[model samples]
Each structure stands twice: as C-alpha cells, then as structure tokens.
Target: MIDDIMSSIFESGIRGRYSFETFVLNLLKEHIAKQDKPFSTNEKNQKLGDGYAEFGFDRFTGPTIVDIKGKASKLTLISAAFGLSARLERACADIENLSNYIIVFGSRVSLEQRKLFDIQLAAKKVSVNKNVNVILWGLDDLDKLATKHKKKTKEIVDNIFSLRLEDAINKSTTDWISERDDLLLKLKSLYKDGQFSLFLGAGVSSSANMPNWEDLLNSLYVKYINNEFSDEGLIDESKISILADWLSSVNDTSTLMVARYLRKALLNGSSEDALFTDQITESLYSNIGDKANDGSPLLTSIVAMCLPKRRGAKVKSIVTYNFDDLLERQLEKSKIDYKCIFSEGVINSPDELPVYHVHGFLPKEKDSFDSIDRSTLVFSEEGYHYIYTNAYHWTNLVQLNSLRDSSCLMIGLSMTDPNLRRLLDISARSTETIKHYAFLRRLTANRILDKNHEEGRVVIEEEVISGLLKRHHTLSEELMKDLGVKVVWYEDHKDLPGILDSIVD
Candidate 1:
C-alpha cells in the first residue's frame, strides 16, 4: 500500500509540473516581478466568499480583482469560469482603497461548459442586476504564456517544487487591469486616428499556410530522410549555416563547437571521415529557403496595411522581419513609392521608406546589400545570438520603436513566440505605446489539467461573445472590444481576405 501511495504521489507531482495551468501562472508571475514598481496580489474576502485582488503602484490606474479557478478535465480547456463567483463578489465600480481588476485562471472549459457559463452569467445579470468583469484565462492563455517563456520559464516550471498558485499571483502576473486597460484604450484611440505599425512573426505566417517552428523542424527532418540520409546521419540545417557563416567571417572557438554539433547530428556513428567533410555540410546548407522570403504575398499584406486607413491613406513607414520582399514587391507593383531598406539599394538611404531585417535576408548578396549568405540566417540559437550582438542593433530597434508609436493592426501572427513578444516589448518601451492587438488563429474550446490531483476535477467554460453573439461569433466580439487594441479574428484563413476587403471598404 505504501509503495502504491508513493508511486501515486510521484505521478501526481509530474502532472503538476507539466500541467498547462502551472505553466501560465508562473509566466505571469515572472513578468509581473520585472515591472518598475512591483505589482501585488492579496487574497480578499468578498460578499460571495474568498477572492483575490491585484494592484499596481507604478502610477495611475485602478485596482484589479482576480478570482482564480483550477481544474483537471478536458472540457474545461476553453475558459476558466469558477473564479467569476469570487470576482463578481469583489467587483465594485468605486473601491475606496484602490482600483480593482478581476482575473480567472484554470485548466480548460469545453463547449458545453461555456454555454452553461453564459446562461449562468445572463441569469445573474437579469436577476441580481450586477455586471461582473470576469476575464477567463484558459488553454489559449496558457499556450501563449508557455510560448513566451519557452526557455527560462520552462526551467522554472520544471523545478516548481516550492512554487504555488498563491505564490505566482504575488510574484509575477499583476492583478492590475486598469493600467493594462488604459494602455489598451490608448491603442484603440490611436486606431481611431490611424497611427500604429505591426511586426509580423511566424504566428502570423502560420495563419497564412505556413508551418510552425516545430512543424518546420519536423518537415526538414523528413526532407533529409527522403533524400536518402540515414537517421544517425541527420544534421540541423540552421547549425551548418551558422558554422559556414562564422568560418567565412572570423574563426573562433564557436566555429569548432558548431562543427562538432553538426558532426554529431550528421555522421555520429560513421567510419567515413570523408562524409563529415566541409563539402558535405556546404551541400546540405543549400537546401534552406525562406518560403515567406519572397514578396509573393506582398499585395495581400499591403491590402491589410491599407485597410485601417481611409481611402488613399498610407502609413508613414512600414517594417517587417520577413526575408522575402513581399511588402516591397507589392508596393512596387502598386506604384507605391517606398524604399527597400533590406536590400543594398536602401542600405545608405535610411531616410527612405524604412524596412529593416534584423536577422538579414536571402536572395541578396553580402556586398550587394549588407546581407550575408543564406547559411547565416537567424534561424538557430547561434544565428540569433549573432544578430542580438550586432553593433547596429540599437538603430534597427529605434526604427521599430518608431513604428510601435503608431497604432498597428496585427494580423496573421500568433502572440506565442517569445522572441517576437520581446521585440514587441522593446518597441513598446521605446515608443511608450502600450496598446496592440493580436489575432488568434487556432484556439482550443476547452482544456484540462492536474487530472492526478484530488481537487483537479474543477471544470469551467464560458460562452461569452456578448449579447446576441454565439460561440461562432465570440472571437469577433472579443477582438472588437473597444477597451484596448481591437482584434478581428477569423476561424479560417480564406475568411481573412474577405474580412480585409470589408475592413478596407
């Protein structure tokens, strides 16, 4: 019996470590702790019962109350709903002490559960005559949080033996919603006046028929295998490029380590030293091409860029991290007078339409445009570090900051990528613009976590797309909220074109 109990405990511990709820809560806490004036959260007792409140002291803003929910079922994947009771109880328009914010955190909520939440909320509104600002943080929130903290946050989560939900609230994610809301409101105002720029990332591309990072890596692996390369003979294409680029520029210890990792990934058990030669790596390096690198979809992106503005209204400048000249191509085709900053043609002309590529680009030669070889693209850890350390890095950022100052309509991008978010954060700080919108493409209806625990069976789901709005229209309503940056989401990519056309018209 004791052995069984021990095994159960060990299994439970593992589940909590990898559970989605734990992952998100930790990330929230991590960011909150980094703020200039630390935010604080304390357990509060409301008329309904025990709830939580989050307050920010940095300056300006109201308090936020959070009612956290925990669960362990697949149906709870969509939204965290239980915390509403506590949040509703604590929610008051005028709090004597401070501003209030309400947040809900939990596993997931299924479709059926979401409907029930809506019905319950409606009943509460009709019978009790109270409006509660209940914010649901479910699977999508967890996924985004996990993606943002993939590196450092993962380590913290894996070793979260001492951390608890209460600990996270006090440490990282602030319960301060007024400031966040204010920033969002400012973004909305900017959109009304037509100002903002967007930094599209892989998440945006994912909505446009491109594979994600994991999918891209897997596809590359398959390509190698199909080309008659053995499993043990596999090599990371990005790593090879880094080595080739560094070797071509300046030789150092990094070059050796790069060569070793390439060797191990490729010819680990092989007796043929000839197979591990530089020529082999060079050949392998030629296979990589940025599918989004070309300007094939520039016209579409331009349409998106033009949609927010009135007829003939154009942004002061545009910037993208994409290697392809899609935006440039579109502008050229449309006779839009814009300078291609990524190309050698605009390298010395910083005053022209600024398009910066921090990671460099393909199709252009080194001396031809300040671009390095294809092998040197920032696709791997080594490649990223190189760009992260560039001398002109601050200048590139200053340009991005300029764009951030303008209200941006973000589309075709997932907010999950950590590096991308970091870039957004940098631009936000530089420009002091806190308002931005993100369009979510793939989202779960419900989720479950900590199934191994005794109290893990908590389930919550909310069907709140607003009055007269159904589940099908929830994304639209949520995206269109006037509080912050307004987001207009589509369930399918094909729908995006029509939506863009409508918005533009």
Candidate 2:
C-alpha cells in the first residue's frame, strides 16, 4: 500500500520540498526520542547550510550535512548533483567535525543516473575519510524506515498523501472556464476601456440557418443548373467550388456572379431577384421594435450584450469576413445606430458604430442587382489575389488598422481562410505589438462503439478516430502559434453569448 501511494506521488511530480523537509525532521526527532538520545534541529543559516545532523558522541558519528530535494528534470538533476558536491567539500573543510553527508529526494533516481552522480562527485576530487560516508535517501528507503517504526509515523504519511491525492483529482476534473478567470478579467478591462473591437466570422451566423462555404456553393450550383442535376449522379459535391470556377471560365464571366446568386437565394429570390430592399427594411424595423425573448437569435443576443445601454454612447467598430448583413440588421434592430462601410469612407458622426464589411455586402439599391459591381465581392481566386496584392485596398486597410490599434476578439473564426490568415500574418510581422484573442470550440474525443459490430472492429475504429483527433490538435497549435493569437476554448456555441456577457461585465 505504501509503495503504491509513493508511486502515484512520484508520477504526479513533487512540487516543493519545504513540507517534505519538515516532515522528515519531525520523524527524525521522534526516532531519536525513542532511542533516548538528544536531537536538536539546527537553525537555518545560509552561511552554514539547510541543517546539520548531530549525535551526542563525537566518536560514534560526527554531525552530518543534510539536504532535501524534490523530483527534478534531467538538467536540474545534474545541476543539483554538482551543487551538493561543492557544498559537501566546503562544509567538510570549514566545520569542526562533519562525518557524513545525507541527501533525501522525494522520488527515486534511476540506477544509471545514480552512477552518473557518483562519477561526477569522484571527478570533483573530493577527499573521503574512513569515518565519513555519503547517504542518499530516496522515497523507497524513506518509506521502509517510516514503516519499520510504523506506530509513530503512519498517521503523518497517510494524512499528507490523502490531501495531495484529493488535490490532484480535483484539478484534473475542473472545467477550463473556471481555470481561465484571469483571461476573462483582461477581456473585461479591454472592453470597459473601449479599446476593443469584434471580428466576426461565418460561425456567428451558423445558428441563424446561414449556409456554410461549401453548402452555399452547392446551393448556387443547384440553382444554376435549374435543379436538373441528379443528386444521385456522379457529381462530386466536394468539388463544387472547382466546378464553379470552370463555369466562370466557360461563360466568360466572373465568379462574382456565383456569389450574387447565393445572396439572392438567401433573400428567398429567384434569378430575376433584382433587389432585397423590402426584406432589408422589414428586418431592420422588426428587430428594433421586437422585445428581447429567450435569446432566440444568437447574433442579436451577442450584439445586445455588447452594446452600451446608455443612449449616445460611442460603440466600438466591428469587422467581419462574412458578406451577410446579419450583424448590421441586429445593430439596427437594437436601435444602436451604426455606419456600414463597404469601401473607403470616414465616419462623420462619432455616435454611430462602424461596421466594416471586408468581404462586401449584398446590394441594398434596386439597380444594384441589375448591374452588380464584381470588384466589391471577394469570392473568386482572382478577387482574393487582387485584394492581397493591393496593400491600399479598403478592406485590407481596415483589417490592418484594426489589428494595429485595438485588441480584437475574433468570434466564430476558424483561422483557415487564406486571405484572413495572410492579412493577420502581415499585421503580426509589421507591428508585433498587440495580442489578439479568439474563442474556439475545444476538440473532444468520441468513442465509437457499434453495438452490432464485432468487438475487435469497434476497438480498431476507436483507435483510428483518436489518432486523427491528436493530429488535428497538434496542427491547430502550430497554426495558432504562427498567427500569434491566443485562443480560449469552450465546449459549445451556445455558451458564446454567456462568454460575451462575462467579458462585458
């Protein structure tokens, strides 16, 4: 039982030596008392050492030099070995009668490492007299001694061991939300000072039935083919983007047409959809007039939590990669006035919040649908190349300026978009001043066990999934490092509103 307890403690790593040293001293005192010999703990004096071991008779064994150590890494162990060797030599030469040196470690040392220490000490050319000896007491040796005198020390060992075990278990099970209180505090500080902005991505709109990149492209393809393509045919859905690219080349048209189709479809319109002026106006009015419910709209709830309650307060700017007007609609509904800037323009009014649509927005005017501006939307390969090459582009300028000036909180962002990643990298390299933050969903393991399958097959499938998750986690860490962004992970998207609320509070 004692060996099992000691092994567990060793695996967990010893933290500090003060408590262990005090316990050892108390045990030594009790042992001396049982033998009817006087024992006194030497006062701590840096000039002398940690403590000294003294027996009443000088002839039996002179005062021993004592040192206590916690478990350490390989480099630390080497340093500890050399340091102890030097201390031993100095003490023996200065003290009156030091006969032995005793060192106690919280964990055992491997045989190879022990031999290395001995060799290092021998190389130091320290003289060893006939009466003096060096003693190393590891956990195993200490346990044996404590158990041999079981009646006196058993309670002390059990009490300390149990407390440490409970602490370890509690730490392992605690939620990350509780552990990251400091990060929350920092966010709140930034928000309160009005030096923070929000950079939103498609993830923020996913809850409102927004289509993802692939899904949006697939929808456009279906619409373009007039629903003639059979879903069961050899059409590979994964390659839909490539197909769109091919369509653009064949028709001698830009891929921006595809984006236009997608936006029109989202507004519940057909190819002849000229404008969404009516829908935009209705959405704007309804959101402003409607009372807050059980937070049915995720984006609106987040905006409400962030917006200042007092009238005429200046709101922080919001930058988004999404082309949809969801955030703008939410702001309008809350009666929080904002400027939607898709191109270069100054906000003449300081009271209204600025929403920079970096990727472009759907046309609000009737004629915009009839003659769409291909340069505004950044969806095609050529569009992305042009935007990135032109440093003075309005979208690039807004994103770079935001990164340089304020600490941004990126929400619903994957850090996977090439354009977004390139812009961040340029800012990080040029300025390297501000630290940005993001909220991501923590990756978790899934145990795959098909009840109808053979047991062996189930085990194999589980292992494969576990391996993939591990690799994904490693790659994610590398990407974050390159981007120089710190991420706070949550379990679910539903928790996002609460997280935003906590930051504001």
Candidate 3:
C-alpha cells in the first residue's frame, strides 16, 4: 500500500495523491489539535507547529505520541528521527517526563538498524535523563495509512498531475503570490507616505565585490602580520592562513576576536588612527575598484527609490551596517544629493538625504571629502561592547530612532545579529505596530515558480513544497512580528529585483 503511494508521489502522472496528502494532513491535525478549543491549522505558529510536514501539540493536554514511520532507508529514518526529535521538543519540553516514545516501521527492522536508530535517538541522552519507550509498527501493523483513505484517488491524482509544473507551483498550498502582492502594496503605501527608511547590511556591499567583515579581518590580519614580520621576511598568504586557523580553531565564531586583535595591533593601535583608516579603506576598495560604481539591478532599483519624486514622499534617511562606501559611491554617481553622517555633532543638511554609517565610514576619500571619522568604525570586540554597553552612544540613538519612528525596509541583512535584535525588540515593545519590513529567503519551503522565467527546469513536488512553505511563511512572519518587522520572503535571490521593482516610486 505504501509502495503504491510512493510511486504515485514520485513517478505516477496523477493528482490522486492529493487524497493521500489530505489524509495525512488531516490525521496529524486531528492528533495534535487541542481538545477543548478549536485548533487552527495555521502552519506558521512556531510554538504549536513545526516547519511543514510536522505538528507540535502542547504537552499540557496532548497525548504521549508514538511516531510511526513507513519503510525507509537508514539515512531516511535517521533524518526523520532528527526532524521528529525537534518537533517533539517543541511539543514536550520535558523529555524526562516523556513516558512512551515508539517508532513503528511499515517494514522489518534489523537488530543493527534498530541499534542505529536507538543511538540516533540516544543523541537526546545529553538532555534526556529517563529511558524512553520504543515500539515497532511493523508491516502487519502499518498498512492502513498508505492503502487509500478516500475514494476517487485515480481521478484526483490524474487532475493534479495533469497540470504543468509551473501551473502547479503557482497554485501550490502556500499561496505566496497573494502574500507578495499584499506586501508590495503595503510597501508602496509606506513609500508614498514618506514613512519608509532603508536599513542596509553587509549583503549590500558584497554585491559590489567587497569582502565581508570576516574576510576583511582575515585580509587585514594577513597584511598586518606580514608588515610586522618584514625584518624576519614576510610570510605567504598560505602561512598566514595556517596561523589564523590555529588561532580560530577553538571558536568558530572568532571574527570578533580577529577584529579585536587587528584593532589593537594594526597601524599600531589607536595611536595611529589615520594610518589604520587608510589601511582599511585601501583593503576595501583595492580589488573592487570602480566595480561598485556600476551598481547591480537590485542596487539600482534601491537607488531609484531614493530619488526624489515630483510630488510624493521620497527616501529621507539610509542606515547601513557596512563600513564601505559602495552605497555612497552609487549615490554620488547617480547625482543624488546625500550626506554621510558618522559622528556625534554632525547631521544632514535640510532637504538632503542622510546616510547614517552606524558601523563607521571608510570612503575612498575623494577630493570633495578629505576628512572622515576613523575612530567611529565598529569592527572589534571593544567597539561592539562600547556601543552595546553605552545606551547613550550616538550610533545607538540613530539606530533606535530609525526603528522607533519609521517603517524601515531592511535589505541584505541576516537578521541574526543580537545587537540588531535587541534594538528591534525595544522598538517593537515601544510601539503598538511598527510595520517594519525585511527581506529573507525561505529555508525549506519557499519556492519561486515563474512561468515566464527562461532558466531552470520547472519545479515539481508542489504538494510537499507548498506545505513546507506555508509553515515557513507563518513562522517567519510571527518571528519578525515580535521584532517589530514584517517579513518579505523570496525563494530565490534573483526574484528580489522583480519584487522590489513592484514597489511604487
């Protein structure tokens, strides 16, 4: 029975498989829903749900679950167990209180394979203190699930599978198209209302071929070491890399550590601030010279939005986490009037755009602008500590004001920075509804199926992917909501320009 279902899913050109999906979704929904109140199938509820194919029930009233699996390879089983473990954790926080946990296979399980799965589950041993119950839903035990729960399977399967992949994807369960349309309208409204502020992160600079902070630190470290070793003879890049590996082996997230060392040693610490700034500025633009001036379509579109309209509201402020001057260079090329504000006493002139460099500024130091604030660069551990610990810091006030006052459109940001998250939290808590926006790609579920797209094969597996996307979208929206922002999701980065273009000028 399960064999036929799998065949229908992957090989058969039939939509009757929809029945199986409906059946499975229904079963899981029924099993996990609250008993007293109506349980919504909102795939996005993080506390009550997993990404897509899984559901997490509240332990207070939910039953002890015995997750049953169909016949699968060891790898597949292991993968499912890991997923189930996460889902179970979301449902029941206390594993020691978990009385029974079973794995029922639709096929036979060898002792070795059984041991393997036990070991896999034993991974929880670090947090789990009590023995877990395990039961097998063997071949004779698990036939009911896959055989067919509803009639008209053949007809439904034929109809669903008949549609071309593109058509199927557009009509997938997640319905991101409608959601995207809604987001665009909201963005346009914000832009027209003059409430939109732009927040840029490292991703924006990389598009122009600038090295990320970590890579910049790596390069700077290599150069600084070579200079220091000039008397003994300079070491090659490979040797510098080896030394770096030795230093960062213990902590994978040692970018800050590297930055701290460089801030202390490079250009002889803060005593030679001018030289340090020059070194960093040279490193940033040496390889990517004039490349950023060309500007990407995404960047161009962003710049267009910044241009003043004949009547409507225009971009008033821009805040970037990058230390490079790529955005400013583009603004200059486009002939848009903008000012770079990086210090305490400075502010943009009236009727001119303000580009706030909360991290610091290291422009190419063109003839027009000879002086810059090198001391404001926030790259090292000490710099971050200073800003985070000092609430009254000028940069903090600037960032806090951006979130607290306007509807910020964040691009090229990972949204993982704790400092940014803290600011967002404060902004969200302070306001009733901030309606800030950020662009993020989907992990497992977000899929873009463009009928007019000239590249790549048509996407299949609409049923599964859509389910996954629905969960992803919901959770992302909810998560960002807590941070006072709305999530604008794209399955592929290429779709970003088109989506951004949809925003009205």
Tens-digit lDDT track of model 3 for 93-131: 633344444454435567777677668766744233244
In model 3, which range of ten residues has the least summed lDDT?
11-20
- Each candidate structure's TM-score, on Cα atoms with residue i matched to residue i, is 0.41, 0.51, 0.60
Tell me which of candidates 1 and 2 scores higher on TM-score: 2
Candidate 1 least-lDDT 10 residues = 1-10
- Clash totals, every prediction: 40, 2, 7
CA RMSD per model (angstroms): 18.2, 17.7, 19.2
User: What is the RMSD of candidate 2?
Assistant: 17.7
For residues 1-505, what per-residue lDDT tens digits would candidate 1 score against the true structure?
Answer: 2122122222232132223333444555565556643433333343322233344422324454433444434233233333344434445533444343433334455566656666755654522213333344455555554565567565655555334433433332222234334444554455446555555555444443444544444333343333443345565555554444444344234433444444445455775544433323233223334433443242475445543244334454555554444455445555555554543334424334555554444332224433333323454455566555663564345444554566565655555444454555454333211255655453323322233234665444334312222332343322232123334444556555554444333
Better of 1 and 3 by TM-score: 3
List the global CA lDDT of all models: 0.43, 0.60, 0.64
Ranking by lDDT: 3, 2, 1
Q: Deviation in angstroms for 470 in model 3?
A: 6.6
Prediction 2 TM-score vs. true: 0.51
Candidate 2 steric clashes: 2
